[model samples]
Target: MVFSWIRKKAADDQEKLKKGDELVIPNQFVCPISLDLMKDPVSLSSGITYDRDSIESWLDGGNFTCPVTNQVLRSFDQIPNHSLRKMIQDWGVANRSYGVDRIPTPKVPVSGIQVSELLFILEDSVESLNGRRCLELVQKVKKWGGESERNRLCVVANGAITVFSAAFDAFARDDSFETNANLLEEMLSNMNWMFPLSQLHSLDHHHTEAAQARLGSRDSLRCLVWLLKCGDLSAKKDSMIALKELVSSDQKHAEALAAIEEASEVLFRLVKDPVCPAITRSSLMVIFHLVSSPSSSTSMAIRSELVKMGLVSLLLELTVDSERSTSEAALGVFDMLCDCEEGKEEAYRNALTFPVLVKKILRVSELATQFSVSAIWKLGRHEKEREKVNIFLAEALQVGIFQKLVLLLQLGCGSVTKEKATELLKTMNPCRPELECVDSVDFKNLKRSF
Candidate 1:
């Protein structure tokens, strides 16, 4: 029975492909420049559809033949868009208003199915839709725009990219890291169609309605999605900064804080975006910076979420870049954090990985010595921490640490008054037995040596 089903499925797939092939391929979908399927189609300022690929091929790669102009398109920029792209843009604008509030609940028309469904289907492969079909459907939905529809399309494209990312990760497990990377690059190239600025006047507009929603509404989910997926590191940082800047006015403080607190959950999700390349890593840094900043008007929800993630150590990691100012600032914050004993404990408890402060100290010995000396001075005399000091010292001594200790003692005593040094020396001397007798001359020489 399974074999028969497989045979039937193969026949159906081939039939569908034949039908797909029979349909007239539009010149609009095909780039005039590369004569390939459009990737990152841009409606240029001149109303022409051109992108990096066209620019490269037509100008630099000597494939300068233009279909419409019948002229050699010397520069990719030369394509005139006086009519073509403007119509698409105008159509998009007109369609956007029609479905602003059309929520795709379970009862909604299947024809009006949104991007989330596409994402869900792809994730489960439930409808047996392949990647090419999935992308085609997304593009189709994008071309037929409503505000809701466009958002849906954007999210679908995002979801498709994620699916590709997952596939790439799986491939990496089979030792195809290079191929996986190439696939990811291709996915990113295709995903450029969902640029936030292209769909709306600004990215903020995309989330404005959702931001206005009551806490935990589906609309809020829209805001969270962009925060997680859309923005680059610099972009995310700027967005957070913009939100924070608004908080000082107090007029929108509560609303902004609420939105950001909701955003924090998304930020947490973003930190785990799997691609830890520089750009994504930088985005994570921006999130940590926001969480660590005292100026941030983040809510309790966000704060608690950060605490759970051991935000302090994460912040420390962000500051590990070669930027001296950043490192010093991070250190200052760390010192302040040390003041909160309970918070420190909580931070350590929740840490994903230990900070390896000792190993780090060894790497940066001068900084480590500064910290260690200060800590030793503070804890060495403390009744509560003395045992810790003894344990630490014993371990150090085992590794021939007496030389370091002697050097430190000399350095520490250099600033001391002679009288104070003498007093310290007296305090440090081991007491002799009262009943023990020695030759007077030998005792005098021993005292001189001491």
Candidate 2:
């Protein structure tokens, strides 16, 4: 009875194909991973079927469980779903007139034996004359690994990070810059993949320490700085991202990065460049992480370089022209810089700093509002400079900064930030009549809060 019903359905499908109608393949026939007809369906220990290539790639990427069931697999073995494959083939045959292509059998996936052999080759290449071969193999692995999460796990499982790190160390040790350039480029490219994967895997402390050590080395630092200056766009972006990851992972790493003389200048140039917004953002992130450290010396070193580089002027420009996130980062960094006297002096010297900071209040994100308020308070608290304070207050009144602060109290802000805003309004008491007369109901309520 079931066989007869199946035959009837097949005949009906063929008739529909003959009439030039589109036949929708059953959802079950589609591979969840690829979202297309499964070429070589296979079942895992968890009883979930997937395209052989997709599942194998997933497993190879270091996943120990099934993608669908999320159940732990007893092993990496996959059994071909021959019955489902036949059904799909039959469907394709019946729909040939409807432009349905036959799903060809897939090739056998990379086996454990092959992975072991590749690892052995990588290990041997460290001291061997097969550096070119080693690079070629690494490139192949990188490309393959990038194709699927499965391949990425396989690469990681095979100790790819350690191999690539060693390769970088080896290339750096060689004095022949011209000779090792290609090799160095390949190693750096591999890092682009390795770093993210390491983070994904939540790599053990030893591996993280090893990576940090390699990146912190003098040779590695010089190479990265050189890459930022001389490498192509992609190389520069990768170097910046790698630096960001290193600093984000550890404060000690950030301190080490800031200690490099070229770090600040190179990052500043990237920020000022208008071509690649991504690189600019990455550069900003690296700077944020550097100054975000608690160490006073680190902040002072970065702040001094930024002040000399005229960071205040650049930040003012970004706040006006760049996106909200960039503006927020600029403000955050600006706020940190203002913690030191040199930073405050530099900011005060920039004519647009106060005006730009005032303009951002209540106009950007909440975080931007907080940073802007803090910055204004920092600048307005010129107790020793009574003359400057009066001059700044007069300027603040003219620019309507006092009016904005009054409105801010009515709008509500964090307690500390609101307190800062309230205090700033009091400091401008000499101009209170000017501030209060700017409006009626709202201005009266703002004064009562003060």
Candidate 3:
């Protein structure tokens, strides 16, 4: 009779839960991520849990809506409060000692296993197998029924961790050249994991220190490539952050610069990475602000580094990047380039650099032409810098930039222009020896005598 009453009460509660009246998820099973029950069927933090594998299978089975929210859950990541991972080891140990049957009832079944990642570490014996033999082994694992397969997968997963750690150690060792690449490549080819196992295997100070030690070194190239190919923005940025820290060390600067160059090369491919957007825009902003400030070590270092990396052209290219911040930064970078005599000389020496500015000025004649005229006037102000200015100015004028400036002048006449541009034109009076093309009539009325 007592058992019958318990059954009746359980049925009533289950019915209540089905209607969404429950405050907490029934502790029938714990979530792997949170190690908690399906409480509130909430997000990753609510300590709620769900049958992720079940949910995944359900989605595969065409059930698209959440059982609780009735809202369409996009993917497992969207399923409310995730299971806390740290609880898993404790739960597993408790279950093993207490016996799974007698373990205190968890909100969910405290299965002593998880599927966060999979690594396939082939033994020397396994590697010796022909392709056909390997395929046969894979088939057997696939066919192995639930519990047995999970156990084998876990063992392999653990072995994979060992192999990955060893491979990273080998990469650190000077003699492991072929072996490191082979092991890393083999691991990548077979494992479902996204990044190198060492990065994902753990987040201890040891790994952090190892990563730091590699910064600005040839080995750093591999890390950069790996991060670019598989890391999230956070990871990529973290690597860059480490690279940034090492830039202060003179001993590491060379390596750091190489790493930055490597990172910059890969940056274009990561435009979609939400974590680290192109430093190009930020760099442009810095260039703009730096140009306005007086000389400083910080500004000098940044300018030197950017110049070394051939980033000036890249910054100029951002004038066309779809982002306004990037375009503005590009404009600012151009402004900075013209601000310094040494930089102006460098730009003048590079003929290719002049065309883009010339083209921009020609297309957006008013804005581009005005900015160029201002820059030219600034350069012209410094008597000592006149030769460099003249060389660049001659190129600009030859490209018909003069014609575009003339158009802007015609438009500005309506706006009562009173500035460097007006002063510059007056100084270079139309009828002068250098202004041979100025016609007689207009030249006489626009004479400097007025």
Candidate 4:
């Protein structure tokens, strides 16, 4: 398993490089202290070169002498050995046949001055009302982010998130989405890779930074909503995707999404007339997070708004044969909505609702099956409508769902799911056709009645 390490180790040591499998490392490439190829080979004042980390660690530990030469160092400065670094890179490339991964170039530290300059230009552009300059600055920062992990951390540390957010607010105030379409797209693309939205939520709402972040979050979300409304087909999809990226997978953005009263309406409009399959899924996700909330009573208002917006039928339409992940997401949200009496009624308004839930079982995934079975049980198990309960059960059986449930139980599932499956089976047991070998079991000698 020792590949050797340079900076990797396997061909080298764990602290230095990836150990190459039995590949002999160049003796010179190996650091004197760590005995591994140096990523940032540096020469000490003692005229010895060691891996930068190894040497620096030694110095930081208050050792005044070189580990190899044992000479007292007059100065602790370690000069970067660029030539040795290049040689290491070349050796790695030449030894690729021996399973040596090419050594990546060492990252240079980002300077605070450099990040400050970038931020200044961005702010200047905002002040001058120069759309062109602002667009260029956005592109430059994006390039920095994409260039290296070091650069991204530096930019983010220097308040690039707050700056880009202010840009969105500025553009929103100007109402220049059409004129600045290209810029908007690039910024959205940039935010996708560089922005850490969790930072927005972690702020203390009373602090100044928190106020700035709140402004950023709301303004950026508003800008995305605006794009969804006025942009072209491609832009609309991009904006929806950006919305998803901003909200992420958590309910952290529940209040943010709900506060933007227009977001739900705009997102629902997209779902009803999706620009693409991707947008439909994104809209569903946003709407799901907006409501299908974590027992937040206030979120119920958002749920009501969506249900009134014809969400029930829209979701049912999306639940059938959709991509696996999207299908599971839609079904999950649909199942959550079923918790409410109004959502339940709205769903029942569609005759295919129960049937669709049946179709998803065992066909999609375990989670989808769980959602489907749970919704069916919640809606059909009790005699909510004593008259129609039999009809619902019949419809479930008509779609071969009884067999699906049996199959689900046979294949095994979670305990809650097992309980629901058992209860539904008992409720619908009398309706299933009898056969000894039908459900992989012998003789239907068991009770014919539950």
Candidate 5:
């Protein structure tokens, strides 16, 4: 009779659970990233627990910091929280009467030994069967690596780069081989995942040079350019990202890439594409990085092409329409471009350039402000046309450039920037005396120091 009564009570509990009853979950069982009961809980070096898949996705996206603590992760390793997993499973079992499902154990992640063996299979054999197997392994590694930082590091540490490079070289060498665009795209994605920007500076010099050589090859360069023009959206983004990494790692690589005529044109097109803001911003950044090294042959080449491609008008437009980072990148590129005669001519000829420059001062971040001021100073110093200079000065006055400059001085800017601003103010003052009293007190104080 007692047993029957217990069974009846259990049935009643299950019935209530099925009737839209709310279940209270313990806080400890929740993953930080998913905010759900962790089916496969893992702990990061930050000592925070998250669902395995959620945390892995976060790390694989090139983020090296702990999401919760915002601290630099000491390691990319994720240790499985077996105790937490078991506890959650136990809770589910205890609540079975309430219709709660028990959590199943997750499969073990790909190991370094397996990755190394597959890499050997790729490198040591040339049979068609081996090639097929190798491609399969590459895809698996990519999938596993994308799920967790540990797998990514393991794949990279196991010489996956060399394996991918070999495959790319083999395919490029033999046009008759069935070239799988998808496979190539996957390889590029994995390469990007392995070598993010943060890891570039730490690479050995030889490694950087080798990468430059491999990527700068005619066949390799052609493939990348083709991918940009014809590949799927994912392929194009990955190609651009890889190109960015290459160019940012060393000046030699930038020069080599700029030497490719098709590359410059493709980058320009990417900049103009409105469909992807992320791609547009990245494209601008690549161009900025390319032209950053002044007095280099590469810089001269890139600047010439930029002018030929109507970069001035585009940059001016982007400055108005883009967000803060994109605006800053545009201004940064403009600053470099204006250093040369051709770039200055293009900028000065544009009616909007000077006005835009004046308005951006004190209107954006300090970096943007600095670039804008420098651009204006460049125009003012280089303008041999007396009438044009007068017109520019008029525009400057009308746009409250003087007030902003005075405010900039009082607020304190870089020494060189302040000197240039002061020089510009002094130059323009002779033409506009009525505006002299605008910030007379602060202006006098700043002038005395100068």
Candidate 6:
């Protein structure tokens, strides 16, 4: 019935255009604001009709005047033009033969009241230990948040994160609840959507208390690690994403996450063997946060743990032929890891390390270049081990690092980068004359410069 568009009304209108292959839609059906056919047209006090979404968006930007008439709105009320909506639907049905489907009767947008009520239900269900109810509520929350940006704002602003955090803490504390994978999956799905919202920390005091309770408890964090290790692919993706958001710019939180028994290994495996783009990106971001600790001891501990998990080699493989952001992220973390001697030795062992760094200079991004140079400088420094230093700089020159550094100095760089490139050029400059002499002469005829 929905696809039934070979109707008499449309046939009458289209018959006149039989020879012409153009669609002659009536201008009345279009919204002035968007210049597109209105999906849900409503009338303002200015007596002008526009799409509900468009007008609401205009008003949300703090506008008071009507867009078409330029008249001051007496009231911000939107009267639904039900009759016009029906006409649009009928027209769409009649024109289905012309590549038009009937307009769907848009569901009433979720309201703050509706979200609050759902939170009420979420609270009640969790308190009763009602598994079936919790599952239903999780699906509902996911659907509501997934509907639109407006609905997402409503769900999160109305304290969804706090409620979910409290519920997670509760579930993690209850050993029996661990078996309820069905609810866990749904809950994780719902939380994944909410976690990326920037409004997470803007909740009320009540919400903050719940969030603290969850984070302060070791078991809740352990439960996340459990999900990372044991859950299915979807569950793992959601958990990884949640962990990334949870650790965003919070050194204390990231420290705790790294301290989890198997978290480092899990993160390492995720980077080494990616489940998908998102999983790998999130896992890298989570590690980046952990390695970025401000505390000296914690930073050392995290880097040491990552070395044990073989993160340096894993990141090297990820950097080559990866997407811009992931490559940048992997390189950034690897740059941080290179601060330690073990990380530098491990990365220095890879044949691709020097070439990859030189290849990415000015080719990727400033940060990638900065990170590449930092790592190179750190690995290339071998003052006591003079032979190792010579061999390392030989590899650097073989990979055309000499040209890249000169070009970098010419192209301009940060003050620190400029200083480093200048020194590298000066260091390699003296060697160039001697290397040219040795290359042009046979090995047997070559004599020691000393």
lDDT per residue (tens digit) for residues 336-363 in model 1: 3333333344433433212222222222
Global CA lDDT of candidate 2, please? 0.75
Clashing pairs in model 2, backbone N/Cα/C closer than 3 A: 57-150, 60-150, 60-154, 61-150, 61-153, 62-153
Task: Give each model's whole-structure lDDT.
Answer: 0.39, 0.75, 0.44, 0.72, 0.75, 0.76
Q: Write candidate 3's Cα lDDT for 97-163 as tens digits.
A: 3332232222322122332222242233244433344334333333332234334344344444343
- In model 3, the runs with Cα more than 4 Å from the true position are 1-231, 234-279, 286-292, 316-325, 362-373, 379-382, 409-418, 427-450
**How do the candidates rank by TM-score, highest first?**
6, 2, 5, 4, 3, 1
Residue 132, candidate 4: how far off, in angstroms? 4.6
User: Estimated TM-score per prediction?
Assistant: 0.27, 0.78, 0.34, 0.67, 0.73, 0.83
Task: Single out the weakest 10-residue window by summed lDDT for candidate 2.
Answer: 439-448
Better of 2 and 3 by lDDT: 2
What is residue 116's positional error in candidate 2, in angstroms? 5.4
lDDT of each residue in 24-63, candidate 6, tens digit only:
6667789999988788899999999999999999998999
Tens-digit per-residue lDDT, 391-416, candidate 2: 66666666667878877887778898
Root-mean-square deviation of each candidate, in angstroms?
A: 20.8, 5.9, 16.0, 8.5, 8.1, 6.8
Off by over 4 Å in 5: 1-90, 93-104, 125-134, 169-178, 197-209, 383-386, 434-450
lDDT of 4 by residue, 306-363 (tens): 7888888888888875899889878877887777777878876798797788777777
lDDT for model 5: 0.75
The TM-score of predicted model 2 comes to 0.78
Candidate 4: misplaced stretches above 4 Å? 1-80, 83-109, 120-133, 179-184, 199-218, 231-238, 245-252, 259-262, 272-278, 294-314, 340-346, 349-351, 381-384, 406-419, 429-450
Q: Let me know the TM-score candidate 1 reaches against the reference structure.
A: 0.27
